[model samples]
Structure formats: C-alpha cells, structure tokens
Target: MNITFLDSSTLHHKNDLDLSPLKQFGDLTLYETSSIEEIATRIADAEIVITNKAVLNKELIEGAKNLKLILSAATGVNQIDLEAAKAHDITVCNVAGYSTPSVAQHAFTFLLNFATSIPKLDSEKQQWPQSPIFTRLDYPAFDLQGKTLGIIGLGAIGKEVAKIAQAFGMNVQALNSSASSAPSGEIPRVNLEALLKTSDVISLHCPLTEETKHLINRESLSMMKSTAFLINTGRGPLINEPDLAEALDKGIIAGAGLDVLSVEPPAEDNPLIHSQHPNLFITPHTAWATIEARHRLLDGLVENIKNYLAGCPSNQVV
Candidate 1:
C-alpha cells in the first residue's frame, strides 16, 4: 500500500498542511517535477498516486501498473485522464468544498473593491499633494447596500457568498445551470438573461463543464449593464477572456475582477495583462490558497486517502 504524492509542492510549501495522517498510512514519496515525461519512472512502484499539478495521462497510467488510486489535492481533475484510469480500474478521488469560505471571501473582496474603487483611491493618495487633483474630491465611491448581487452558481460557495452579500444589505439572486430540487430561501433563482440585465455585481462560482465553458461570452456581456461589475472566482475557461477584454475596452461593463484566467500563469501576450483599462483587476489564481482553506483541504485529502485504504472510497469519481 505504498503512496506517492507527485507535485506535493503545492501543499508541502504551505505552512498549514498536516502530514501526520498521511504518514500513518504507508510509505509516502513526494516529488516536484516540471516534466510529465518523468512520471512513469517516478511512479513505477507506487500503489496510490496523489497529485496536485502532475498530469496522470494514459501513458503514465498504463505504465504505473501497481497504481490503484489517484487522489487529487484539488477539486478539478481535468489534468487526469479519467477514461484511461477507469479502463485500468483505478479509483480517482478529489477534495471538494474545502475552500468554500476562502473562495467566497475572495469573490467579496473583488466585489467590494469594484464597488468602492478602493485601488483607485489608494493610488490617488500617493500622488495627492503633488497633483492639483488632491484639492478636489473627484473620485467617488459607491456603497454596496441596496445593490443587486447575481451569482452564477448555487453550490456551497455560492450560498456562502449570498449569505455575506445579504449581510452587506445586498439583494442576492442566483442562476443554477440546472434547476435544483431544494428551495433557496431569500436568494431567488433567476434566469441568466434576467440576472445579467439586473445585477449591479455578478460573481461566478460554478465548475467548468461542457455546458458551462465560456458561459460568459460576447452575447451575454452585451446584455449586462454598462455600470455592472463582473467577478470570476471560478474556473478560468468559464469566461471567454477575449470577450471580456473587448467588453472592458468598449465599456460594456464597468470593470472585471478575475481570480482565474484562461491559462494558468497567463502568457505575456495575454490581453488582460496589458489592458489599458484601469478597472480590470487580475489576481494570480489563488482564491483557494488561504491558510485556513489549505488546512481544510489537507484534512479532507487525508480523509479521502484513509477512506480509500479502508475499501470504501470517499469523494470517488468515475
């Protein structure tokens, strides 16, 4: 029952990860590799493979004949070859809901910054006395109270965002990709078109799936009010980056706050990187890396591994 964690750097580098439970299971080997070519040889004798960024494709899965399970430290398993793993009878598990609070807080941070023009004001203070603009109260900030906040996902994180929005005196509404059997109190469910047209601030917290990919695109952007703000704390591909850039250029929306991009470590030529728009704020994909959230993720990951060892896999994926 040997277990190896490939790309454990994402967790081990964080101060919060508790490796005690993982050590109790079996021999735990960890590595940080930039090359996928090295995976087969590295995982040859491992029965369980835990990966955060390492790609477990068909070739690597085939080569690791002893591998029984793959426990992804993150929620998304897009990097893994699910079909090949299923063919090899390898169980795959992913930790979910571990970063609900962390992500939700980030979404609100963006919303508040957009609503109040916090960054703009902070920058103004630096050049205040030297410039003539310091004498005038030219920059105005808006309050979030009585504003409509639209959420694209109604999952745990979305629900948390809604609760916090309500605490801020905002009117919270949501649009679920599919209809839910359970009722959402206070937060009324609305259609995409309605939410886009009416919301003062819109936030995304959905998973990236076939139907949800580029859910916010050119056509949808056109429907939003010019003063509305868009926030994405979800998957990068969920919104078309180019379309968002055009929207910002044309003033289709007031601004955008994105924690995810179409690509991780976005290229130098990325439109969002050099956009002249002062309203656009882009953060390196770190909405889930808060100290508290990483601890929860580690705890859940250990539980997943422990459950798998007990022959009753938790968080099992097809």
Candidate 2:
C-alpha cells in the first residue's frame, strides 16, 4: 500500500496539510517535481499516485506496475490520460466544487475592476501631483447596478456568481452547454449568440472541452457591445488569446479581464502581455488557489485515497 504524491510541492508550499489520515492507510512518498519525465521514475513502485500538475500518460502509467489509484488534487483532469487509466484498471478521482467560492470571488474581482476602471484610476492617482486637478474629474467610473451580467456555463460556481451579482442589482442571464438542461430560476438560460450580443458584462465559468475550446473567438467578440467587458475565470483555452488581443486592439469590446490564459506562465511573445489597452487585466491563474479552497482540495484528495484503500473509493472517475 504505497502512496506517492508527485508534485506535492503545489499543496505543501501553501498550507500545513495533515497527512495523518493518509499515513494511516499506507506508506506515503512526496515529490516536488511535476515534469512527466520526473514523475515516471517517482511513481515506479507506488500503488496510489497523488498529483496536482503531473501528467500521467500511457507511457508513464504503464511503467507503474503497482499503481492502482490516481488521485488528482484539483478538479481538472486534462493533464491525466483517463482512457489509458481506465484500460489499466487504475481508479482515477478528482476533487471538485472545492474551489467554487475562491474562483467565483476572483471572477467578481475582475468584473469589478473592469466595470469601474479601477486599475486605470489607480495608476492615474499615483501621477496626480504632476497633472492638473481637472484631469482627476475626467475619468468617471460606472456602477454595476442595472448592468446585464451574462454567464456562460451556469454550474455551481456560475450560480454562486449570479447570486452575488443579483445582490448588486445586476440582471443575470446564462448560456447552457446543453439546450435541454438549461439553467432555470432567476438566471434564465439564453443562447451563446444572444448572451454575447446583449450582455453588459460577460463572464465565463465553463469547463474546457472540445466543444467549449475557443468558445470566445473573433466572431463572438464582434457580437459583444463596444462598452461590454469580458471576464474569464474558468479555463484558458475557453477563449482564443490571439483573437482576444485583436479584439482589444480594435476596441471590439470595451475590455477584458482574464484569470486564465492559453498557456500558464504565458510566453513573453503572448499578445496579452503587451496589449495596448489600459482596460485589459491579466492575472496569473490564481483564481482557484485560495487558502480555504486548497484546504478543501487537500481534504478531498486524502479522503479519496482512504476510500480507495478501503475498497469503496469515492470521487472515482474511472
């Protein structure tokens, strides 16, 4: 019953995780590296592999003869090869809903920054001493009240965001992934095109999938209001970065605030890095890494490992 955590550094560096429960089940080994090449060696003799960013493909999975469980610390399992794990009889589980609050809060933070032009105002205030007093009055901010908030993928996190938006007097609407299971109640579900055309502030909260990848592109950007702002806290590939940069340059929309990008630690050549607009806000993908959320994720991962050893695994993906 060997349990090895590859890339434990992601969780270890944040909070003090109680590994007492995990230790009770089996021998535990923790590693810091997330590289595929590194993980292949570290997980060689382990029965259960706990990972946050390490990629477990067929090549790596086949090498781990004793591996029986794959416990992903986070919700997204895109880094793991699910089909291969299923074929190998490896139980794959992921922690979900743990980051709902953290991610939802981050989405609103971006929305507020765009709605109020907080960054531009903050920058201007720093230079106020050199400017005329009249310049201060030029940058008026808008209120969130009466604005239409369009949400894409009204899942738990999106619903939470809608509830908060309602508190600020915002009219909320959503675009559902499937037409039949449309989100009901106060947040009426609308089509993608309609959401883009009518929303004053569009926020993305959907998972990244084949159908959802590049959901926001040049054509969709063109449908948005010139004054509308786009906020994405869901996944990076959900929006096309190049198309978004072009839109920002041409003023296709008012601006954008992205917490996720097509590439993590985006390349220096990325357009968003050098966009010529004061309206764009780019944050390192920290929307789901809040302390509270990380704790929940850790708890879930340990529970999954315990359950797997107990012969009744919870959160099993395969």
- lDDT of residue 265 for candidate 2: 79
Lowest-sum lDDT 10-residue window in model 2: 176-185
Across 113-198, the per-residue lDDT of candidate 1 in tens digits comes to: 87777788788776677776535365577889999999998799999999999999999888854534336455677788988999
Clashing pairs in 1: none
Residue 242 shift from truth in candidate 1, angstroms:
1.2
User: Which has the greatest lDDT?
Assistant: 1
Residue 239, candidate 2: C-alpha displacement in angstroms: 1.2
**lDDT on C-alpha atoms for all candidate structures:** 0.87, 0.86
* Candidate 2 global CA lDDT score: 0.86
